[model samples]
Target: MLLCFMGSIDRFRETVPLAELEREGRVQTSVDGRALALFHHEGEIRVVDNRCPHMGFPLSEGSVEDGVLTCHWHHARFELSCGDTFDPWADDVQTFPVEIRDGSVYVDPHPEPDEPPAEHWMRRLEDGLEQNLRLVVAKSAIGLADAGVSSDAVVERGVRFGSRYRESGWGPGLTILAAMRNVLPDLADDDRKRALYQGLVHVAGDCADAPPRFDQEPFDTEDVSFERLKAWFRENIKVRDADGAERVLRTAIANGADDAHLAEMLVAAATDHRYLNTGHTLDFVNKACEVLDHVGWDHGDAVLPSLIEGMATATRAEERSSWRQPVDLAAMVSETFADLDSLVESGAGTEWSPPASFTETLLSDDPEIVVAALEDAIREGASVEALAREVAFAAGTRVAQFATVNEFSDWNTVHHTFTYANAVHQLARRTGARELYRGVFDAAINVYLDRFLNTPPAPLPRPASSTETDLSVHLDELLDSFDVEGEVDEAGRRAAHYLDCGGDVSLLRERLAESLLREDAGFHTYQALEAGFTQAELRDSPEEVRTLLVAVARYLSAHFPTRREREQTFTIAARLHRGEKIHEEGQ
Candidate 1:
């Protein structure tokens, strides 16, 4: 009788006879259903997992020399006494305790684990991130998942890492992670890992070439007035004094300014320059806040100050010729700012609900009318947050209705407006600052300018157009629609059909995520999906949700069928994760 002990107790199971093992030089046996190879190395029996760590090739076929075991498949060498690999990529093989007694060889199939799951994977994650090894990163994600760690945990790790390591502050990688996190709930369990893996890989790429960020010291004073700190922060940002701004911001936090207070200061400064860097500064601030929302504001020391570089040094829209062109849009926005305070006071505490056609009016061809309508809303007692939500939705319509016939780059023109408005809306909701109404107006103007990209707006998927009831079928059709070019409208219709027929929202979200992840998706592609889900939540009517979803589908479809090189890289990662022999020729 033979048995292997597991679960903290050591029990031995029989393998081949010791004489037979020495004669053959190696023996293959299974104990507790785990295949192990016993080798006669240096006149002693050594046992190891039969499968190679590199590619699962049988270790019995490997040769031993000078007490070193080498996997024949990849020629990876390991010290026989332990499982440590000589080659880093090969990874360490798993070894078992072996004993020879009564002319027979036995193994303790279960021994102490090498390391806790978290410890090993976290180390591998750092290795993966530091080395920019996509395969290693993928394996870390898989390993962590197997250990029952939440996807959020992985994402937060990436956030902290990307935020800390990159001297450039927040950029596409963090934004991409934030966007992916925004839609994380919409993804299936497996896809969630894929999404996080994608996020981590991008962060690695972003920080690989970038300099590391060093923390700036806060002002010595621990007790400063909020008004004074706010004023100082805004002033430093205005003059592009990043060091001074970081000091001001850090000092504010040092003085115990709450999250809302910090948001208030950032909001005022972000709008001070009239859409800083095509509204990216505000969006960056918003994303910083957003990421903090996930990872906790206690990370403010690391997270919030990073916004300093972007905000202080960002180019203002007003500085651009486009904002001052034939329309003199810059002058027009300033004029609105002039009247903003008085207008907001007139509607103080009176919540003026926008008309049903409010979004349509915001889409007016005339920037003048768009701003005027916003002023009217403010005078009608519309709160800054409410107006911002309306403006953001209107911006979403620009992307939802974007025409593919235009120069492809135009998608970003509309995309910047949508994400900017979304950011403004999020901040307004948080700070409830009447000052942020400036962003609302700026967004509406952008919407007005972006009108032609939708000159012949892609027709919204006809309402309830499909009678199809099977949810799975809808998801299949929706995903299949992206295989070829020119499936934009088809994708939109399928998404509409899925949502309109009371199909599971989660299912729709899952399919949308799957479709997006499969392609060589761009930054804006991620924005479209996340923004759609976010904007959808803000609307009361189911129809509004449908509109946003269709917009999401249309945008993704319009950009579908990319080279998908990323997917191939992910495939290799997945194969390695399963410990499959990826090296065998045609096997």
Candidate 2:
């Protein structure tokens, strides 16, 4: 039986008769256009949103047992009294304050005064982390930001959970955070939150259900020699003994090892092994240092050890046939190491036209010859910086030049070489350590290793002369032709034309950004865009920037033929956020 509506001006409307709720155990009703379920338990009535948070199922059809309501669809359960969910993916439903007056039940239909949004969302973030709830994680990140929590706080929360939960050390989740963080300042305000959510999704997803590894207490040493500690650190790191490595590092820091020396130690150890962990180990090491930089160095003792653990456990990329075979690239890499000092000394610094020259050697398909040419160029006074710049361009070219392959995953195969080379370029630039030349050599060899992936190479457009037609007008037409091979060939040609007509390098950056922003992009595409911007900043001459941008144009044209699928995901999330129902109860 239904009761006549009555309240303080209809604020708390009578929902259902107490006897009907008690007998039926639960009842469904609508209050001010909102679906709600009323349940009778232990002589008390509880009311909550009737639509399941997971898929918006009608909770009226759900069963109430043992103080929990289980939605039939997907079996998501919520507490009858509090509306808290048993599953993170389902999310907690909203509960309304309930009242009883003379055989009648009433609901306020408005949330009671409670915790602030920031605190609530922060708690939700913790729950999301605990249950590895990706959607919840994203929603909480956005919520926290909207509630005025600092990005640093949000980042610290994730880092704390990631470092604690993933005992084996920094993995792809943390790496994704590190990488995307670089692009954060450049993204639009809304995109910054999206990037943060993207990073948190990975971080939480990574540590979900992972066994926690306890960190060992730092060694209490007062008088350890810096050299000996460094030596011990390298040895332990080599053996993948994280505890021992941490003790050594802690001891060295205790003995007044500044950031520069510590950085040198990391760089030394990173480059000590050839392209350690197929170059990712070194990249992780760099990123870990960067993380320490992001969060105060005070947290170094806690965070840096994870990187050591990651390096010690990582598989050597050189061991793979893809990196080892045909060119005997590893041996060539070793040979370059033997004469690195001489090569650096030999460079008298010359303006060798980049990227064009670098591309020629990469296409030669001979790792030894490429190394020999690099040494010769350095010996002939080609600045190491110049070589580094050209190397980055060549790396981008590898991506831009990639022809269609049967394996879809090959995109990453090619991307790894580019990223590795870019990493080497960045690290070498940062430390200016002479030994990093070996890293440059490793990058070259990997480039050689990827030679076959670019079968049926796309032709690069030539540099344009003054008075060439404005290329911006054809942007859409060129992009439209991107999906079909050889159809978007004009993209490269237009890039050349733009560069030839004395176009500002900023325009290159703008065009690349425009092309990417026009469609949804995956991680690789985002990374590629970052690499292009990084190259533009690192290079001096217009020619270098032009080569990098042209490569970007070619790569985007080839790789991004259609809008990415993430667009639809964001769209659905928006609709649901606005309180719109997405799917029918059962259909």
Candidate 3:
């Protein structure tokens, strides 16, 4: 097929036979060296350049079915309505209009005029919005799935397959379904309304089809998908577009949507992800505080404490040098609360305190405080897991910075001490607190010595050795130095002697205890003694502890009689300084 530009509609009408061409199913034509395919269906005639947009395939040879002309070579379909290719990979085809008048059908060898019908324009807008809704729902569904919700669960929650109007104007149809509880009072209780709101929030940006780019952050220009669009919307929500902002706001308000709510939701979503960047988070916090002060939630007295607590949580997390920081959730929450407070302060209305216990418990730093707060928040309709995680994170940060075993032990004195203890243990492992950990392990072993007496402590794994030192001999020498025959608890006395000899007796004594308690105690006992002697020598004179530790670790591993015990011995020895308990039973 070809593009036959017959000058103008009038000139073309006079030249071509309008009636005879319509009677024929197809017509072959040419223009500009390109072949063309012309066909009539239901009184409407379409003329398209015959080449497939994806590849140079003949359209005349293709089949016309269901208002689509399909290429025979690649099955690329072009819609006769728009002359646009249906294949996602294909480009649009060139279409020309045909008019039938008198006895002739005239093919206007020119591009169709840009005169879109009113209905077509409306359909275009509606279709774009519908496509956006589908994209939102699909993205939200994936996010919910990731968050451990099944597809069946989402459906059960009343998220039917339909679109809903969101204040933000960018959410899925599911959001509209959720809002129906509010729109239709007799549908469900206020409790359902709240649930729906939360569900809508959960899925709001869950299925963003594109990734977002924050201010000043570089974005990949090529992958501008739905996610990117939402991101751009979020980043630019507060920015006033001189030409359209007023019109957009006026239109939304006229449609019964709250303009302020839309703006706030946009800000909330944008700020949520970027809140950790100090500059951005602080800005939101300050704005939230201002809102609170204006509304009465700031109550003067409540503001500082809230800000301090929130900032403290942020600062602690920051100080720990963690790769991923908390989302400054506390700050976000504080700002939100402050906003509510402002409403009351202005006498617009008294905002319901989000359950006094709820606020107190969530803002607390203590695990017990958090637990209590979580329980209260859960009862008061807050996300229990989310609040619990927030508290856990704050407590974890403090535990990571603990310098002494006493601090860790003290922190565990409260109820629900396991969480704190676990945190302490994790921090101990991370910090390479081998010596301090040895002390803790020794203390534990001492408490359970009788129970472990019959069972041999598992062997320590051997480490890769860089030196050829005979660690066994060195241990034997250290053991020989101990006056096991003395009246004193010889083990303790020996440990003191090792200490005096400049050994890291703290770790050595723990290792010795572990070795004695386990079945493969012989080799580990020997290595522990050797390590102790080496440590002693290094401390008392001009030797390096790294050399000794590395050498002893390797030697014990090499000489181990059993491969099973070898790795055990080396690992235990390597982590001797780390606070992991030496398991008496083998895995």
Q: Which is the leading candidate under lDDT?
A: 1
Which 10-residue window in model 1 sums to the lowest lDDT? 1-10
Looking at candidate 2, what is the lDDT of residue 345?
70
Q: Best to worst by TM-score, what's the order? A: 1, 2, 3
In candidate 2, which residue ranges exceed 4 Å CA deviation?
1-36, 40-42, 100-106, 109-113, 186-190, 225-227, 239-242, 253-260, 314-369, 376-387, 405-410, 452-456, 461-529, 536-573, 585-587
**Highest TM-score model number:** 1
List model 2 lDDT by residue over 418-487, tens digit each. 7767776776666665656666776777777777777766556665577756656545455555655545
lDDT of 2 at 583: 68
Candidate 1 lDDT over residue span 1-587, tens digit each? 53335554448877788889889988888888787988887777889998876667888888989888988877989988898888766667889997777999978888888899877888888878876777678778878987888767787788888888888788778888878877777888778778887778888888897788988788898667899999998898888888888888888888888899999999998888888888878887887788778777887877788777888778888888878887899899898899888997898777788899998899888887788888888899988888888888888888878888989889889989988999999898899976798888788888888999989987787767446566677778888888878788889888888887778776787788898887778777887788788888777787878888888888888899899877766676677667565666795
Model 3 vs. true fold: TM = 0.23
TM-score of each: 0.92, 0.77, 0.23
lDDT of 3 by residue, 317-351 (tens): 12232212333334433343444333223433222
- Candidate structures ordered by lDDT, highest first: 1, 2, 3
Which TM-score value belongs to model 1?
A: 0.92
Weakest 10 consecutive residues of candidate 3 by summed lDDT: 441-450
